[model samples]
Target: MLRNIVEEHFDNDPDVTIAAAKQIRRMDRDYADVGDKLYALQIAKGNRLLDEDDLDGSWGQFDEAGALKPDAPEAPNGKRQVLLAKGWKEMERCYHACPDLAIDALEQIMQIDANFREARSKLYALYVSKADRLGRACDRDGAFPHLMRALEIYPEGGEAQQGLAVCTPTPIPTPPPAAPVQVPTVTPRVVLPTPPPPPPNSPTDISAAPNSPTDPPVVRANASSAAHPAEKSARTGCARAEQSARTGCPVTEDSWRTKLITLAA
Candidate 1:
């Protein structure tokens, strides 16, 4: 009885709706009998809260003691009747006469009376509106979960089932290959000059270089080069040509080989 009274008080006050809903659930499994005055007061207040656009308005007025109530006051049934009329008017304006408020009102009613199918149907429609909105958002993934939840709540609901099918993303298609274009090719008319020979290394300069002191000390020309036959070449620094001593191609002349030996010495 106390719990019912508390919930009724809360239903009359939009600010207390959450607390009222909680207390309403704590009441007797069938709400037992908390007095018709108190029960009807809570139901009417709950209806007003659902109807208000702000969803923050009070469901009922005040008492002689100056105490506020969420639901209608019990001692003055006549005053409660007047308040209920006002609440209904406010609800009608806030809800735009849509059946949406019916679902909210029914939800509260179900807490007091579990076997209320009228409220269940209204709640189901609310779910449909929510699912439809979700499906149209960039995060369509979010809508799928709600749709599944709605299906769980109403397994026979065709809207929920149909929405699930329509929201699936379409598969991407493969495009055909583009035709290839022919590009002009150019032949070289001028040959680049061969690179100059690298400089010779000095024994004293090589010795001053860093290395493990314990390693064998040696100084030698660190030169490297490669050349192909039929190419005219110039000698610079310590370079000498020995025809590559290969079998088939034009070999280095004996005179060039002699000059290379002299440079090494």
Candidate 2:
């Protein structure tokens, strides 16, 4: 208890008990420091358990003494020399049935010292096995945690890296849907055959007013008789064109010819 308290609580006194423990184990190989005579009683109890084929109980007592007496080179039971042996034995006995129970036994060995012989490697392998099983079952969420634990112990392990990738999800790219085909719609143009443009004299044809067939002859005659030809022709020809238009009769070609002869004279 004192050793556990000192190692667990005080940061400075952790190794303080090592020297004293060594001396006690050297003189009293049975561990006089443990409490009255707990070590002796454990040995008796271990012998009785062994007689009953209780290998587990016997191993526990042996291991407890090993912890109490680290430096007892010649101590009958010895210090963890068989550290991995007992866990391996237990794992073998129950591994085919309940792997976790066997794994727990190995983990207890790890608590004593993680690097103890093959315990770390064995524990890491078990984690990989569990990871593979869960991943194969499509339980990635369950698999990843075990893979992470394995990596923590052996960061560069190939099995752990492979298992992690197996458990990881991959995204599939979906192609965009195909574009729909467009059909051409033809609207027939209702070409009401251009209603042959109204005659140039028609009152509705504003576009034809400048070149009215009836106004052009009068315009040419008025232009010849006046000095400011464009201004005078515009005023006189437009007035005659308006009168001819209102009377619904075109100007006589003879009237235009007469105007032209007067201008010449």
lDDT of 1: 0.53
Best by TM-score: 2
Ten-residue region with minimum lDDT total, candidate 2: 72-81
Alpha-carbon RMSD of each model: 29.4, 17.6
Total clashes for model 1: 7
lDDT tens per residue, model 2, 11-119? 3342344344444456666654533233444455555555565667666765655454555432244224344556667877866688778779778878777877677
Tens digit of lDDT per residue, candidate 1, span 1-265?
5565455655455345534444554564345443343445444554454455323333332232112233534525534334444444443453435645644554454455434434455456666676787777755677787677667667899998898887775668878888788777888699899986656673456557777789876666544344433233554311332334333344446656786799999
Q: How displaced is residue 131 in candidate 2, in Å? A: 1.6
Model 2, which residues run further than 4 Å from truth? 1-85, 170-199, 202-265
Which pairs of residues collide in candidate 2?
none
